[model samples]
Target: MRENDGKSIIIRRSRGWIPINWRDLYEYRELLYFLTWRDLKVKYKQTLLGAAWAVLQPLFMMFMFTIFFGRMAKVPSDGVPYPIFSYSGLILWTYFAGALSMSSNSLVGGSHLISKIYFPRLLMPTASTLAGLVDYLIALGVMVFLMIWYHFPPSPGLLVLPLVVFCGFLAATGVGLWLSAMNVEYRDIRFVIPFLIQLWLFATPVIYPVTMLPEKYRWLLALNPMSGVIEAHRACILGHKPIDWISLEISFAIILLIFITGLYYFKRMEKTFADVI
Candidate 1:
């Protein structure tokens, strides 16, 4: 901390419109933790299945995909079984999907806290995204059991799983920012989220491997950030091939773009949140 003439100088705005204070976020890290914990507990509070629901959402989706796509349509999995292939990717997808959807609504959901408190507004959605990691890890545990049941050895490329997951986090957080800010002013944004995710799932290589698509169409898949994330997950988990560095790079680039632009827009609109909501 520094002071000029005993009056602390605070950064007033980012560039011109966006407002960001990294120091404030660091100072309030405990609030972030409490908010994340609250979200996790609230999610499982009234449910009989409790944490098991986290494992089951992706697990059952895998079962349906296996029965339909694997058995009936004969979907290709790049030399791996469709169930484990889909399950591995689903572990990540389920988390991103939940986090994005929840984060989009978080600001509105926490309107009471937002109106009363002076905490960093970004913390709301960021906490929601981090909270979903619990479900993601539970589903990942199920994935490990599935791998053993299918006798699939860990891929050497599994070393890169952390990188892939980080990309998904960035993408989810980025989209969450934009959506949450928009949702405050325009409530219909919430209705669009479910439909958006449905279309997005088909766009990503979840039930089928990237190789299952035509060569020309494959190029378009990279435009969907999750496409690369899911593809990298499959590659690293099943040893499909060396990591698709090109797609992974493209995904990272998009994640960065989304994060920057989303943060900017969210901050730009943040001044209107209390008044508008």
Candidate 2:
């Protein structure tokens, strides 16, 4: 409270779902920075492998998929080699899996701050999601090496790689917000996230080409947002096929719907966090 001419003035946060205080986010930007940095440090603090885990996680998965799916099952990669094909998909998939896992647990993990302070609860999940970008960049470097080793040259479509990554970010952040808010009250969401990620991976064409499915059934893939994002990544990075705009549009629509609803749900639930936590 500030005293002015013997009167006190009070400021309050707008509680409505649509009216967010953007100024508050801007003011707390430094706190977001600290939270992101802290998350990165804490994630690798005691690990013997440290940051190498980022590269190893996806790289090892690529090897396993290449051996089983590429060699045994003879999974088609739309003419792209199996190892690079799977590794490219794994780069984005790993980031999304990590982002979704960390962000969903962020609120419960930071319960101490929630009970003791008045900062935007959204920052907890946002920081958690952003911190995984460090791992994404590291894994992406390995992808570059694979592309060179395989003598694959990127097409002009490669320029759209950022858009594909952003779509994945939106999908992860949307699901993260919903799960984190619900996890604050229920606490069971933590267990469900791993299962959800595993199911989602098979639903997406990460290990195989979407073309293996009949064209009549291909429409169902559009319902899965990562399907378009991962497919777009292959088209851009591998340059074997044109980007699937129709599927991508549908995916974007679904992602936007999820993101907006998640924001509203998160805001609605945050009011109870300090007390419940």
Candidate 3:
């Protein structure tokens, strides 16, 4: 073997705990790209409908919410057209749900690769989360078309949409990292994740406006980071008003907390992945 190969093999077999070499991840960026592309292609390959599933999901949900919540329950939509208001929230929420679901199972799904390979285990979940962005963009195109059809012009605040989306990603990734790592040891988290996400969706302001909550409870509601994100999406698209800075700040803080905590937990469990998985 070459000298560098010998050195790498020695390092891999060394005794004490090793710090996660993040620079190695950057060096392997090409692998990350390939993994992400593979997931994207596999998601649509051999499917009759292909990308249509993306547009269909949020569109169908928006219709149901408009029918039941807008018409039946008489839920307020902050004075914007109910379909547009709900569709915007659904677009963001769907991305979060899809990413969370895929990522939580990513390590288990890639067990073959993990057991046989030396790449960063974190890449598995990261690729899954990144792949969900394709669906988000496809679904977002439908939302844009709906906006034009409804005669709603895009607002200047829409410039911040990317930041809002990033926050959603961070939140998803944070929770996903923890779940993916733990799932390697205990498979029960897999079954529990769906139920948790369902509860999370209702807790969020997806079907109804945040204004429907009593003023006294608004601060309490902001404890769920998604509440702030959904409200920001609506405010940006509908121009109903500026974002609630206080809520946004609280949500941002929580995202950071989850991110740091998740990273630590993921790294802590990473070494045992090959053994458990």
| Number of clashing pairs per prediction, in order | 0, 0, 0
lDDT of 2 by residue, 1-277 (tens): 3565534535666466645658778879999999999999999998999999999999999999999999999999889899999998999999999999999999999999999999988899989988998999899888888888999886899899888988988989999999999998998888999999999999999999998999999989999988999888878888888998888888999998999899999988888899887
Task: Please report how far candidate 3 places residue 249 from its true position, in Å.
Answer: 2.0
Off by over 4 Å in 2: 1-18
- All candidates in order of lDDT, best leading: 2, 1, 3
Question: What residue pairs are clashing in model 1?
Answer: none
Please report, in order, the local distance difference test score of every candidate based on alpha carbons: 0.89, 0.90, 0.87
**TM-score between model 2 and native:** 0.94
Which stretches in model 3 have alpha-carbon errors above 4 Å?
A: 1-18
**What local lDDT does model 1 show for residue 5?**
54
Model 1 local distance difference test score: 0.89
Q: Write one digit per residue (lDDT tens) for candidate 1, span 1-277.
A: 4565544755544356655878778889999999999999999898898999999899889899999999999998878888888898888999999999999999999998888878889999999999998888778887788888999888889889888888888899999999999999999999999999999999998888787788988889989988988888878987868888999999899999999999999998887788788
lDDT of 3 by residue, 148-218 (tens): 98888888988888888888888888889999998999999999999998999999998888889899988
**CA lDDT, candidate 1, residue 145:** 83
